[model samples]
Target: MVDVQGTVTDGFEPVRDAFAENFARRGERGAAVALYRDGRKVVDLWAGTKDADAPGDGPSAPWERGTAQIVRSATKGVAAAVPLLLHQRGLVDLDAPVGTYWPEFKAAGKERVLVRHLLAHRAGLPALDTPLTPAEAVDGVSGPRALAAQAPAWEPGTDHGYHAQTYSWLIGELVERITGRSAGRWIAEEIAGPLGLDLWIGLPESERHRPGRISDVEPPADPAAPGLRMRPRKAVTDAYDDPASLTRRAFAAISPAADENAPAWRAAELPASAGIATAEGLARFYASLIGDVDGHRRLFAPATLTLARTEESAGPDRVLIVNTRFGLGYMLHGPASPLLGPGSFGHPGRGGSLAFADPESGISFGYVTNGMQKNVTADPRAQALVRGVARALAG
Candidate 1:
């Protein structure tokens, strides 16, 4: 407990303790967690170092209020909202074929893929037959062009896989094709700006230099950090190591994975990943998804909210090699990525970040950390804080 800062409404002291325990017992380098109940923020706490990459444990900036970090795949939840919002406004049709918007997607036997199928991870186009280099991925045209011409691994909409990296183009191109604007610009003007959230899909240069900004993520200093999951390790490792495994190909769609800390990756908008936000912004964004935030109206209407949390896919995930559940773009509370019980829908960044909203309990939560971990989902530190929130509610 290196002096956790920020308020945690009287009942939420447990959550603050949980945040502290992450640093003390879980090898956390720097992190923040926030919570909103109904429409009000009940917790906002941060601790540990801000410059996680600073050499040799030398003196570095303290993690302070307004610290933000890239939430990796958690960007899916935010990106999912873009299409959903468009549908809500009658600009996009979920049931229609994605080719209705992006004609190029009609090639390679994918003309039948529905818009909802993309969101539900059932487009059957998870891995690229030919992978892109890191530079080619952010080059704007290569990713989408490769996906449009490549046939689905499985018949379109016949099965589901995590989509992994290909999801960037699946959704990004669709958004751009329909809105006549970059997905990043649409998000900023439509969702982030109106909601007054400090979230960004494409981070700007000014945010890069700010004090306490989560510009980079770093590995845990400790040798024995928590790993990918609680399981017999060999099986998972084999799946990841197999050259032809969906797990391998899907994750490696962009070989070597782009340097997420680099300025170029931050500037390019990749909807399936590469979104950044503070714990407060992440929590508040999800809070607004399910209900109003502060005085602003909620992003999703009641019917749209129902559609979002409704389970669209479940069972052994093709890429993850685990039982996972999804509701459109958001991950549902499930065996693989349990959140706060049923109806909790959100996404977790493979690195250390988690955010979700439980419409059933009227709770929205976020945890952002510079200490990247191997755990893809249900990260122990985040799970501990989620438990604390559940405890606070019970108390």
Candidate 2:
């Protein structure tokens, strides 16, 4: 068995057991899970190897308490706060047209796209006609420029779809235009730094050789792992398989996929995808969103917190083809997303990373894994840990 490490308050032993079961029965390789309740750490655990750089049946490096990894689309939740924070400070108007901030955005049909529309995934600019090459995608200017030139797939705010790769440029460009700084730098200085968080929007060069330098994990070796597997959905599979489908096109907006472990990709701030964080850092971030952290002030005021969980858009997502719920950039608890509770809000990475906060329960949770799986929103490994939290709360 892969030995689990870290501590949990007395009531959280169920979470430790769940973390162990993930490796023993759920096909979890290298993974970590953490949670904060009422602003204090309640669960922190890690298990298995940091196989991001290691490969094959070779001896593996042990996963450490401070290890971090790219959290894929989960980055959206972290990046979402940037614009909202700006709005909180009266620097950006949520209802105003995005063109009000970035004039060139008005050149295309996007003139009608409002700030809230972008947050709600209703800007209707999911798939790109001309996708960016991996190099161009991370070049900073190329992404936002490409998105600015494209016409919307639907009328802005009339419908909703997961922006997928386009979201990086959409949110990142707005941050740059507003702060005159890169999204990564802004997040580091404003959000992560103040909170003393081990989170990074774009991983830095100096951090590469640091004690917990992150790398990409290998894909699942067994799709039919006994503990959990995908519920067969022909429609979901068909949509993704078809090149002409919006689902496929939206995900393909980055064209040739970038190697996530590549330093270049890590150094460039793709706010939608390139976030790197340890389990605790991510959970602590969510804790501060819903309440104070260790007596420190929270990032979201009550009004802002309400804005984050308010239903901005909910229904069949045009790109995902699955019924989804969104509040600004945060994904709400729903059928497709099994977060903590009805009041929960956060985003999940494409494969195994997940994080969220439930103000009603005073719970902020995060889980990250090197065991990339076919599961998207509610990875079984993550849900297991979440259920453990529920058990702890019950007692």
Candidate 3:
């Protein structure tokens, strides 16, 4: 039996049970789950070995409270927050053309693309026609230049699609153009440092030893195939399976993908995909978004928070080929990735990691795993824990 450790408020023991059951039934490696309610930490639990294959017969290093994991696309939520916070501070206007801030974005007939279009995935700049090497991508050298020169896959704001890797460079460059600070640096100074969250877009060399090694798990059987809980529409499955589809191209924007666990990758700032954080860190960050955490500070005002969560796009996604919904910069609760309630908003990583805040329930949740299950939107393990959270709240 795996030994799960941490505290849960009196009524939330079910969350701990679900966390352990993930190890027994869902094959979880090192992982953690945390929750905050009304700005107070309610549940914080972690279990399993940090280095599952640690050398000899000696005991493996346990997953520690400080251990962080690379949360692939879940980083999108954090990155999105940077710009939204700036918008709240009157630094950027959502309705203004992105070219207003970054003049070069006016190239390729993209002069009218609004800042909100980028946040809501309606800019239609999903895949780059020119592929970038992993090294050039990590060094922040090629992605922005290539994207600015390429035309959109569809008319900007006419359709919505997941930008995948392109989102990092697009938003990061926007932040840099406006603030004269890289998104990572601005986040460190304004968000993470103020909140004291152990999250990083561009991790420092000194923190290199903190992240656990990530390993991929076999993907779940196709949902469109027989014996699945939910069958996808033909268009959804077709787009994902075709190598030449926009869906595939967007995800593969970085050709010969960079090694995610490498020191170089961690040290670079890929705002959309390469964020590092512990489950607690993610939960606390979300908690701050919805309300105050530890009397430290709240990131969004009520008006700005409302705008951030308002649905900007809802329909078939050109790249994902599924009916998806998005807010200003976060994934809304929907068929693609459901969180606590209709009011819940957040992003899920390409793998199993997920973090969200439910304004209705005053719940902020985060879950991270070193063992990655290949579910694009919802991972079953995280879903199970979410169910446990629902049950606890209901009781």
Best lDDT among the predictions, by candidate number: 2
Distance from true location, Cα of 49 in model 2, Å = 0.4
Per-residue lDDT of model 3, residues 1-395, tens digit only: 99998889999998998999999999888889999999999999999877644568688778877678888889999999988999999999999999999888899899999999999999989998877888988777688888789898889998899998999999999999999999988988988888888889998777876344332222222223111123455666777678788887888788877777677887889999899888988999999998988877688899878977899999887876667799998999987787889999999987689999998899999998877765778788899999999999999
lDDT tens digits by residue: candidate 1, 83-156: 89899999999999988998888998998999999999999998998999989988889999998898988886
RMSD of each: 2.3, 2.5, 2.7
What are the Cα lDDT values of the candidates?
0.85, 0.86, 0.85
Candidate 2, residues 25-141, lDDT tens digits: the string is 888879889999999998888878887547576877888878898898899999999999999999999999999989999967888899999999999998889888989988888
Check candidate 3 and list the clashing pairs: none
Candidate 1, superposed: residue stretches over 4 Å from native:
219-232
Better of 2 and 3 by lDDT: 2
TM-score of each: 0.95, 0.95, 0.94
Query: Candidate 2 — which residues are off by over 4 angstroms?
Result: 219-232
Alpha-carbon deviation at 261 in model 2, angstroms: 1.2
Q: What pairs collide in candidate 2?
A: none
TM-score of 2: 0.95
